[model samples]
Target: MIPAAAWGYQISSYPGTGGIWLRRAAVPHTGVVMPDDTDPANGPTSGSASSEAQRRTELGAFLRLRRERTTPEDAGISRGTRRRTPGLRREEVAQLSGVGVAWYTWLEQGRRINPSVQVLDAIARTLRLDRTERDHLYRLADIPGVPLDVSATQPQPPEHQTILDALIPLPATIVTARYDVLAFNDAYAALDPGLALLPAADRNVLWHLFTAEEHLQPLVEWEREVSFMVAQLRAESGRRLGDPHWTGFIRQFSETNGRFAEIWARHEVASSVTRRKSFWTVDGDEISVIATGFAMASTPDTKMWIYTPDDARSQRLLGLLVGRYQELGPAELLRRGARTGGAGRSSAH
Candidate 1:
């Protein structure tokens, strides 16, 4: 049986084997093998042969798309003659990807071949695949994908809360390594209702920036913020490439968000968690929020997000939203950030 936590799965018994294999024939990305030793002969059953076929078909589409997007110029091949297609030919791709023409053809044809990690990595690099795409490539091959360490940090010791409180009127929050909003005083919530309404699955800032339209569309500078978030997560993923949770999250989100899917295909890996970001206060106000990362005393994946308005204008606007320092306008009651933590970012495996 596949783990319940796994998504997009159904059970089917193999011909002779007592157990089942998670054969994904439709959407290759989610098709994972939940192999059972008892039944090996039933032609690799997972839900039904259709699911496996669907998966294979999707894999073919992904490979073809990758191939079509890359050009001779991208592969450093001379475009001496007029080309019949927009991108590099299959032969050029095979050459640039460092795989034999026949092998690449078989892969594009959806033939059964277990691609190695090294080869897949090379192909991803050659195709200029971003972190998400690289993760997808691995998934299509049915390789055990990277995991994410989504463990919540231990509760902040009283001293830590005191530190957060000492920050005073300044908005501050303690977050887990996965960006879980662990703890924040009223000050933090006093600034942004959206922050308080941060979705349970969006504790990770990157995931929220990429997947949550409500959280992101409101941002005055959506593209810049989302790009930076992607770069930062890409950097983090690099450090923990073998983590399954992170990999799965990347995959699920890519499948859902077209914008994220496009950007992730670029294969740009970077980290800028400490960069500055500007936010618009709810009361038609604007302010700059600079991020600073602080390590936890004892907990892993725990850090703090501090928001200091650039000036009094932003401060007043924030107060109006949270109803804490009612100066700009009447105070309004807003839900505080979730007291209990929620799930961390998804893996892209």
Candidate 2:
């Protein structure tokens, strides 16, 4: 699950992370996140101290304001009658959020420290933040929040499926800048049959290209197409340099595929472009396509890629492929699609 605030996901109030949340190892001690001011990357790093510093300071103040306004009764807690300050104390917020005073102090003080998504969600809930306020808090922190529940995020509209299906013979699919395949037509499924077999998370073009899935084939200009994909991904990665999910995708691919790691290390960059592309099927058949894209206005950084048959042979093949899909139907196709072990071995297993 990813942050809902940025990706149309509703804020989740899950009390636990459900899986392994932290990296490395967990320390059985309080004040686990020791403050380090020397690390330039510790706090926001936009060059403008006024802007970044102000954002962090505002974030701290915002948390403080919420804490001060909410009474102990609202938080379902009480500290006998000796309390001097109004609302819950700094220590109380930390304790309620399952964090330490020292760590939360730095967070509240706008110090250089990164808070985990779970911790932020906990804090937001403790402060009784609404969806809009949660979004604001994440924005102030310069962090894209992930919803604890996958369902917290919205799904593609029913009309999108109809739009995809209407493309008929033309192989078309909607994908994010990250090449995450959101929706596809029957022709697309026919052209790249392996796509429908994978789980939702593995429904990525990059994953399909490198994995044991037979999605990749002999191309017209050798491996230039794949190289272009890598370059394009690198170019778009600038939008989310420290994003966990984006970084994890790169890390997993780099760890698993040597060629991918090598290409990624080049730092080459490219953008999406219309071009004539050719692909060879496992059956030794070739299909040429004129690939064009249409931006989806409703979904940010998402576009529809349409592959039109460029040659007579391709046109015939595409028609045959669509017919094949129709004959098998969705139910039969799904029944035949078996799940594979994804990009890498999950840490959980």
Which candidate leads in TM-score?
Answer: 2
TM-score of 1: 0.47
Query: Candidate 2, which ten residues in sequence have the lowest lDDT sum?
Result: 340-349
> How accurate locally, in lDDT, is each candidate?
0.59, 0.69
Residue 298 deviation, candidate 2, in Å? 5.0
lDDT of 1 by residue, 83-200 (tens): 7766767667767767765556546656555565666766887888875677777777666543323333434478877887778567788875445566776666555445556644
For residues 22-60, what per-residue lDDT tens digits would candidate 2 score against the true structure? 322132333234333333557544467557678778999
TM-score for candidate 2, please give it. 0.61
lDDT leader: 2
Q: What is the C-alpha RMSD of each candidate to the true structure, in Å?
A: 19.8, 12.4
Question: If scored against the real structure, what TM-score would every candidate get?
Answer: 0.47, 0.61
